[model samples]
Target: MKLTISDLAKMTGLAKSTISGVLNNKDGFSEKTRQKVLQAAEQYGYVPNEIARGLSTKYTKTIGLVIKDIANPFYSKLTKGVQEVAGEYGYTVFLCSSFEDHHTEKEQIQAMLSRRVDGLIVAPLLEEVTFDHLFDLKAKSVPFVLLGSVPGLDSSYVEFDDYDGGRQVTEHLLERGHRSIGFAAGLPTSRASRERLRACRDVLSAHGLALRPEFTFEGAQELADGVEIGRKLIAMKERPSALICFDDVVALGVVKAFQSEGLRIPEEMSLTGFDDIDLMIFPLTTVSIPTYEAGKALARTLFGRIFGGPDTPPQRIVFDEKLVVRSSVRTAAN
Candidate 1:
């Protein structure tokens, strides 16, 4: 049995409109009357219907967060940051994962819209350029902030300086006298991977060296991919002295594959990774991005659009990536 506003009004000897106004926190109700209605509602255990209220006010007090993969530690940290800020604003978050599938991403966005979420924070899939679902959201005037870059989207986004991060890694390797270097790329369509690869090439070009075409490995999205790449490198007649992986997970996989064959890290071959994930077993030389802080920024940017008017100019927040040197990379002998 549920207590309605009418029941609350009868219990407190007040008009139904008075009870409704007080419960909804609308203006014009006297403090005494407000307290009276609240006391009766509390005593009677009256719970307001959120769906009904949302219809009247057009504010659901909820938001949706869609990420690439929830199992990834980077997104996990990012989610915590978004939740912390959303909590402070009295908003509930509906989380969804695309699992790096474009069709699934479209379905998730449609589901969020059907639920009437106030806003959305999405980490768009960089694989395959079509974003008709996201464009539809724009046409519908829904507020959304992207977590990563999507070329020609013309939307608000939060991203790390992947190009600069790649430059740093390549420069560091060059400084360590590592001229023969290889790059293990992520999904071929990934913008981050492309930017990093561009940086590596640019830096190497400036040093009168070039990334060998055969040295570049692509389509590394999982640990198994890294293991396969590792085996390929081992069988090569001449392999690069160092390898820069797309991310920490792939780097870890490569490390595992190498160790299984008695290959010592930074001794026989050096390796580095991006998005320095917290892994105790491997002290990888990688680029560290402030993933948690980036998540908070994504939510904050979305809320700004939600409350600060839709006319607010789109914001592009870019966080810097730091290169953390560890035992995985070493100076090459001249």
Candidate 2:
């Protein structure tokens, strides 16, 4: 026994079209008529069907958000930021995890698009060079903002200053008199990873030193990967005096592995990490990226594109990363 707009119209003694206009908040309706319709609807406990309303207004009042990994604390903070802003605008967010897979990312994007979300915030797989799926989104005129670097794709995005962060950490290690350094890289296809590795190399080159190929390890995204890398480093006949990890998670795993092997941090080896996630109990030196602020910025930018008309210029915001020095790294013997 659900009440419909026609029932509301009959109850209010108004035309069905009048009832619809008033309920939808469309202009050209008198205040008295609007109030009457509202009162009637409230008396009947009528709830507007969102799907039906969307069909007429063309807005679902929902947005899609896709991130690399939901399990990552960085994205968790970022998602919180996005949800906070979305709540203020009376919009719901549909979150999806890409799991760092290109095919999965594309499928999730299509699913979100099929649901007719008002806009999207994506952290696309930067490992793959092709972005046909993103191009398709643009061709379909769907508003979206990227959360990370996607080289050659001229789109609205918010990214971290990974290069500078790399330099900061590398220079700090160098200033501590540690010339023999190692880099634990993330995905090789990631532009952020490449930029960070490049910065490390550049800084090392400036100091008349070079990162040894044998010491550089790639594909260290998870804790297990870091543990494996740590075991490999321990087995090495000649290990670097210090290591720079891709993220805090990996660094934590490495620290655990090193400690289990009776190696003391800073005294035996120094370590640094990026994306200073709160999960780490170890006082590891790392770069802190403002992931929550970046999320808020992404939502704000996406809304701007959604409501600011098609002519709204694309914006690219880059947040600088800060190096948080801690006891994990100490001055090396000259």
Candidate 3:
């Protein structure tokens, strides 16, 4: 025997019509009556048919979040932030992982749109996200907030100062007297990677230091990719005495390769990485960005647009990145 609205009304000794008004927040329903209805519904363990309610309200009060990789701790933190804020606002979240596949990203976005989620938070797969697939979402005027970098989108986003992070790391190594610095660049097609590489170049140029074309190798930010880059560096005749990796995962891989070669960190070579993910394993010199805070701010802005008021200026917020000095880098002997 399933409990329905009528059962709830009967259990509360209220008329069904009165119960309906209170449940839907209809005019002329006092807060006292609303509480009574809600209490009865809770006591009876009554679950409202939200599908029908969505048809009436034209909204599901649900948000869809898409991440490129769930295994990455950075995205996990971002998801946590979104979930925390979503809970605060009484909204439900539907999370999906694209696995860095553009095709999967397209399909996920379509499914979310078909379900008519109130809004979406997307971390684009690559720099060139297929705008055509997003057309239906745009046509429907669905609100979306971009989490990571998307070049020239002119949309609302919350991202880190990746360029500054790159420049800061490079300069830190340089200040420690490291002249032959190698770089483990991520996929150049990614906006975030591009910004990081640009910052590396800019900082090098600022100091009149020439960037060795052979020293700059691009790869995925995974640990395996880092190991591959490490092997290539180790095999060089005159390898770089220092390295700046794309992210913490790559840094860990590089450390593995270095250890395998019996090359000590900060003793024979120095290294720096970006995105200071859980440093408990092998603390590395890196930059820590407020990934979770960025997510929360982006959600706040998106919620504001969906429920707060009419459109305001396109909000572009960049969270600060700080350098975490650790035992990964050594002062190069002059």
Q: What is the Å distance of residue 103 in model 3 from its true position?
A: 1.7
> 271 in model 2: Cα distance from truth in Å?
0.5
Q: List per-prediction Cα lDDT, in the order shown.
A: 0.89, 0.89, 0.81
Look at candidate 2 and tell me the lDDT of residue 213.
94
- Residue-level error in angstroms, candidate 2, position 144: 1.0
List the candidates ranked by TM-score, beginning with the highest. Answer: 2, 1, 3
TM-score of each: 0.94, 0.94, 0.89
Error of 1 at 309 (Å): 0.9
Error of 1 at 11 (Å): 3.1
Tens-digit per-residue lDDT, 88-136, candidate 3: 9988999898877788888999888888888888887663546655555
Q: 1-334 in candidate 1: lDDT tens per residue?
A: 7778888888889999999988878999899999999888888789998887888888999999998778878889999999999999999999999887888988999999999999999988776658788777787889999887666778889999999999999999999989999999988656678889999999999999999989999989878888988888888989899999988878888998898988889998999999988763688889998999998999999999999877989899999999999888888995
> Lowest lDDT 10-mer window, candidate 3?
127-136
Off by over 4 Å in 3: 6-17, 25-43, 134-139
Clashing residue pairs, backbone N/CA/C < 3 A, model 1? none
lDDT digits (tens) for residues 5-116 of candidate 2? 8888788888999988887789998889989988888888998788877887889999999988888788899999999999999999999998888899999999998999
